[model samples]
Target: MSSAMTNERLARLYDRIEIQELLYRYARGVDRKDWDAVRAVYHPDAFDDHGNYKGDIDGFIASLQQRHAHIEQSMHVIANCIIEFDTPDSALVESYFITYQRVLPSAGDARANYFLREPLADDEAVQGQAIGRYADRVTRRDGVWRIEKRAVIYEVYRGMPTIPGGRLRDNWTISSRDGRDPLELLRIELGLGEAR
Candidate 1:
């Protein structure tokens, strides 16, 4: 192959690997509940269009922190990523994400309902899984590609009835405009708006 062809092939391979790593990092951060790490996978101005959090990165994290609290354990599986290179510096990626939510009964609730003996079994509290997909627009900035925008569409939620939390309603008020701090909004929602 010519040098140009070889270079093109190598670039494609590199982009593919990098994109896979990016997705893996996102999954790891989310599963581990490492908000900072999850935040690092996106651009500073990134926005997400999740059915739960239709706003910026701060909104997304706030929503996640609230929504995932009821879930004792969860897993995110990413696959079938179709990445199209618009140039050497930008791409559009569509990835399939399947998330599983395992509910842990609260201490009081578990003791009252599911406790068959003095001690609880390890597996008794698991709820089930929720599957979804991620449609994203990624861009390379400073030589590192990151998700610039993302929209999560849930295909199915096959688990126990969801427990309502204050987090879901928090993002509903966020405008599409920039400069809103999600944490501030959360504090306001909780009636702790005063700076500590």
Candidate 2:
């Protein structure tokens, strides 16, 4: 009986870790524009209700790609994740997230609609920030965990002018424009293939 209980605990711990990792990978995929990695974490029939955007997985993917097109840099941090198991293969999850993005000046008039930021001049850039919680229903299918549904609740959203000459890069590692970021390239070199 004690050994059986230990096994159950181990299984639960493993599930928790897998679910958390799924959320982290989702963030990484979005920041790096790695759509395949993002799609891999969701059910085919998944629905994402992201305030301004609401639709199935395919539409969600399209919206994501479109939304970030005019933005140059994006960073997302997920924290305070709480998970509750509904069944051996299903769980409810809530994860708090903060996202920071730098919108290019070329966005110009288009920024007013999607970005909700003021129009910028030819050489001006703006930074945007949002704080939200992702309430998700996650399920394990074929021994793999994925999001079945997700609703993003925003607590804060705003944009401001970036400080001039704020960029101070001292390292050689630069984030790639495509999904072939340095980390992914290194992982591939080590035979990891961009997934855990």
Candidate 3:
């Protein structure tokens, strides 16, 4: 390949890595329920459409805060990130995200953690399997890349505000990340594995 072609390829690869890292940060922020961190991933005037939300960046995130407050814990998984750059500073990205919310006990003794263990309840977990895509137009402003526009799409919303461990009570455990595979990490995060 010519020098110019080689340089272009390397630049594209770098851009892809950067976009993936940015997306991972976005997911981490959402999972941690850090609204401020989540907001920082976008431009000041970015647009978003999260199905449950349809507004500008600020308005959309405000709605997210209100909704997220009702859940106890959430996990956001993003994968298969495909970023296509229109220019060195601008791109469109489509990524897959799976979000899970642990529902709080609404009835019975929720605080009572210890009791005769029975079947896990279904009213305590909500899993969203989203074939979601984000359309982002990014630009480097002030020597930093920021998403100028964003749109979100959700493909599946499974389960509900029910207990996630109810069905798989015997499968909950921690993972020791000595050198875990990326796919394994994904499965564990998605509730597809027992506690290790």
What are the runs in model 2 whose C-alpha is more than 4 Å off?
113-119, 163-166, 170-172, 194-196
Better of 1 and 3 by lDDT: 1
The 0-to-1 C-alpha lDDT of every candidate, in the order given, reads 0.70, 0.85, 0.64
Better of 1 and 2 by lDDT: 2
Best by TM-score: 2
Local accuracy of candidate 2 as per-residue lDDT tens digits, 1-196:
6999999999999999999999999998888888888999999999999988898989999988887787788889999999999899999999999998877767777555534544555676678899999999999999999999999999988887763233747575667647667888888889987543
Q: What is the lDDT of candidate 2?
A: 0.85
Residue 70, candidate 2: Cα error in Å is: 1.0
Best-fitting candidate, measured by lDDT? 2
- Models ranked on lDDT: 2, 1, 3
Model 2 pairs in collision: none
* Poorest stretch of ten by lDDT in candidate 1: 174-183
Q: RMSD, each candidate, Å?
A: 12.6, 2.7, 9.1
Which parts of model 3 are misplaced by more than 4 Å? 105-131, 164-196
Model 1: what TM-score? 0.69
- Count backbone overlaps in model 1: 0
